[model samples]
Target chain A: MADPDSNDTVISGVAPGISRSAPQSKEEVIVISHLYKSFGSNRVLQDFNLTLYKGQNIVVLGKSGSGKSVLIKCIIGLLRPDAGEIFVFGKNVPELNHFALDELRARIGFLFQSNALYDSMTVRDNLEFPLRRHWIQVTQAQVNDMVMEALEDVGLAHTVDMMPVELSGGMRKRIALARTLILKPDIILYDEPTTGLDPITGKEIIDLIVEIQNKYNTASLIISHDMNCVRLASDLVAVLIEGKCYALDTYDRLKSSTDPNVKPFFEQ
Target chain B: MATDTTLKKFLDETGRIAVFTGRFLNEWFRPRYEISEFFRQCYIIGYKSLPLIGLTGFIIGLVMTMQLRPSMVNYGVESQIPAIVGISIIREIGPIITALIFAGKIGSSIGAELGSMKVTEQIDAMEVSGTNPFKYLVVSRVLATTFMLPVLVLLSDCIALYGSYLGVNIKGITSWSLFWNKVFTNLIYADIFPAFIKTFFFGFIVGIIGCYKGYHSSKGTEGVGRSANSSVVVSSVLIFITDLLVVQVTDLIGYG
Candidate 1:
C-alpha cells in the first residue's frame, strides 16, 4: 500500500511497458504516477500511471466504474487521490492548495459528463463566464468578439443569445465545447463527450474534438468507453483495466492487440 | 464503536461547515464583486419575499389582538390593547414570523438553486472556469439575506401594527391617530434595537445554512430536494434557537 500523503514528483518519458511512440514534442503537460485512490474498501485507482504530452490526445478507455472519471476529476483537482503525484504544468495537483488549484484550472478546461452550462444564464453568458472570471481586465467589446469567435469555432454562432435548455443535445454539447474554448486553455479534459448522443451527433462531436485539438494545438485527455470516439479522436489509447494503465498504443495497434483485457475494447 | 463513528461524522460535518463559512469570509473582500448578481439575489430573496411575510404578519397581529381583547376586557384594561400588541409585534413576534417566512421562501430557493447547480455540475463548471462560485453564488446570497431580512422584518412590523389597529377598531371605537399614539408611546429604543439586531443574525443563519446545504449537496436530483427541505427545517430551528439565546442575553443585559 502506498503512503496516502506522498508528495508528487516531476518525471520524463512514459513509464516502462507503455510502448506507444511518444509525441514528437517532448514537452510533457500532465504526468500521473503511482496514483492510488479508494473509497472505503473499494480501491478505485491503484498504481495508475500515464504521461500526456503537449498537443496530444490520449483517450483512457475503460468500462463504467473503472475510475476513468476519477482520473479526470483528480487531474482537474476535483478529487484528491490518496497517493501519487499528478503533475500538471510543474505543480502537483493533490498537493496544491485551493487557490493554486483554482489558478491551474483556469489554464485547463474540463467538459463535464453533462454539458453543465448554467441553465439560468444565456448562451452568451456561458461563454463569457470563463473570460470574465480569468481576465477581468478584458473590455466588454473584446469579450463580445471572443464569445462570437468561440461560438463560430463550434459553428453555433447563432445560438449565442439562446438559453441552454432551448438547445438540442448535440447543440448543447457544441455550446459546451465553445464555452471551454472561450478560455483558450492549453489543456482540455473531456469526460465522455460523445455519450448519450445519437451516432451522427456523436461523430460530429468527435470531429469537433479533433478540429479543436488541431486548431488550438491543445493536449486533450478524453475519458470514454465510446469505441468510435477512441478510434477517431485518440492520438494514443490507454487501456485502463482494474485501476491501472494496462496498455498504451495507437488505435490501429490496439485494435490488433492479442491480450484478452485489451481485445474486448477493440472488438467493440 | 457505533457511537464513536456517529460522533466523528458529526464533528466532521461541523468542521466542514465551519470551513465553508471561513472560505466565504476570506473571499468576501476580494475585488470584482458580482454587483449585478448580488442585486438580483436581493430582488429575488428580499424584495420578492415581502408579500408573504406581510400577509403572515397581518394575520398574526389581527388574531393576537382579537384573542387578547377578551382577556383585556376581563382585566378591565381593554384600552391597553394597542400598547400590548405594539410591544409584542415590534419586540418579538414581528421579527420571528418574518424570519420563519423568509426561511421557508428564500432558504429553500437558495438550496434548490445551488443544489441543482451542484447535481448538474454547473458549480464545478464555474470553478474550472476560474470563477469563485463561493464569491459568485454564496457571498452575494448570504449578504443579501443578512441585509434584506431586517428590512423585511421592519416592514412587517409596521404592517402588523396596522392590522392590530384594524383589529382594535372591529369591536370598539379608537381613532387611527390615538391608536398609533398608544402603540408608539410604549415602543422604546431597547425593544426595537435588540429585536432589529437579532434579525441580522437570523438572516445570516438562513443564508449560510442554505448555501452550505446546497453547495455540498450529493447523491443526485433527490439530493436537491433534500437540500431544499433540510435548509428550511434547519434554518427554522436555528432561528428559534437563536431567538431563545438572544432573548436570554437581552434579559441579562437589562433590555427586558
Candidate 2:
C-alpha cells in the first residue's frame, strides 16, 4: 500500500509541509490514558490511550459507529466516561466542575459533524454567538473585526450576512469552521469534517483544515474515516477499532503495516 | 405483568420530570442570567400567541353566553347571564382554555425546537461553546412561558368578556357599565386570586414539560416529532390534573 500510490499521496503533495511523520515537540497538550466508556452494555471506548502534542493534528481514524464521536465528547466533558481520565492541558476533564469545564472549553474548539449552526441565526449572529456566550468582554467594533477575521480565515467573508439555511452544504460547513475559529481555541476537535460534503467540497475542507492548522498553529484532534481527510490533514493517525486504539502511527508507516486489521483501512 | 411495566414506566417518567424540574430550579437562579434570550423567548412564546388565544377566548365566551341565555330565561332570570358567565370564565373556563391553547402552541414548538437542537448536536455545540444549553435554551424559555401565560390569560379573559358583552347585546340591550358591573360584583377575591394564581402553575407545567421532553429528546427527526407531540399531550393532561388538585385544595381552604 505504501508503493508511492499517487492518488493517496496527491492531497498531501498539494499542501506542502502538512503531513508530519512525528511530533515536533514533547509538549503534551492532551494526555488520555485508560479511558473506558460505555452506554449500558455497549462499550464504545475501552482502554483508549492517545496523546496530542502542541501544534499537532492527530486524526482518530475509525469506521462508522466505532465510537469516534464518543471519544471527542468525553474530552470536552459533554459525556462523563464510565472509567477514565482525559487530561487536557494538565487538568483532568472528568474531575472538573461545570465552571471549570466551561473555562477549559473556552480554550478547546469543537466542530460538530452536522455543523450544528444555529438555524434561527444569521451567519453574522452565528459567528458572534460564542463571543457573548463565553462572556468574552469585547466592544462591538472588536467583535465585528474578530468575526470578519474568522470568516476571512475560511475564505467566506461574503457569507457574513446570509442565514445558515441560505448557504449550501459546503458553505454551512465553512461557516461552522468560522465559528470554531472565532474562539481561537488552543485545541480544536473536528467531528467528521468531510462527511456530508461532495468529494470536491470535502477536499476543500481538508485543505482548509491544513491551512487553519498552519496559520493558527493550534493542536487538533480530528475524528474521521475519510481517507482523503486522513491523508491531507493528519500529522499522526490513531486507528480506532473495537473500542481501542488499535494502531497509532504515521500514514506512510500504517500504509506499509502488514497487520490484517490495519491493512484493510489503508487499502480503502 | 404488562400493567406492572406500564406502571413502572409511568413512575420512571414522573421521576425523571421531577429531576429535570429540580435541575431547572437549581440553575435558573444562579449567575450569568440570559436576559436578552429570556426577553426574546417572551416575545416568541407570549406575544406571538396572543391572536390565537384571543380568538379562542372570544369564540368560547360568545358561545357560552348564548348557550346559557335560554336556561336563565327559563326561570325569568335572563339578567343573570353576565354574572353567571363572568364567574365561570374567571374562575375556571378562562384560565383552563387559555392554558390548553398555550399548551398546544408553545409546548409543541418548544419541544420540537429543543428536540431538533438535541438531535443536531446544537445543544452540545452550545455546551462546548462554554454556554450552558439548559441555561440558555431551557431556563429562558421556561421563564418566558411561566411569566407570559399569566399575561396572555389576563388578556384572553378581557377579550372573552368583551365577546360575552357582544353576545349579550345580540339578544338584548344591556349597557356596558351594567354588564361590567354585574360581572365584577359576582367575582370575589377568592375567585379572581385563586384562578389567577393557578395560571402561573399552568404556565410552569407547560414550560417545564415542553423543556423536559425536548431537552431529553432522542432518536432523530422522528424523535423531534415525538417530543413536540408528547409535550403538548403531557402538558395538557397535567394542566387538568393540576387544576383538579388546586380546585380541591381551594375548596378545602374555603376559597371554592
Which candidate leads the pack in lDDT?
A: 2
Model 1 TM: 0.90
Model 1, stretches more than 4 Å misplaced? A1-24, A95-100, B1-16, B22-36
lDDT of 2 by residue, A1-268 (tens): 2232433221221112354332345788999999999988988999888888888888888888899999999999998998988999999999999889988988999999999999999999999998988889999999999999999999999999998889999999999999999989889999999998899999999999888887878899999889989888887788888898877767776778776667788898
lDDT of all the models against the reference?
Answer: 0.88, 0.90
- Tell me the spans in candidate 2 whose CA falls farther than 4 Å from its real position: A1-23
> Model 2 over residues B1-256: C-alpha lDDT tens digits?
9999999999999999999999999999998899999999999999999999999999989999999998888999999899999999999999999999999999999999999999999999999888888999999999999999999999999999999999999989999999999999888999899999999999999999999999999999999999999999999999999999999999999998
Lowest summed lDDT across 10 adjacent residues in model 2 chain B is found at B126-135
Residues A100-188, candidate 1, lDDT per residue (tens digit)?
Answer: 88788888988888999999999999999888777557888999999999999999999988999999999999999999988889999
Per-model TM-score, in order, reads 0.90, 0.95
Candidate whose TM-score is highest = 2
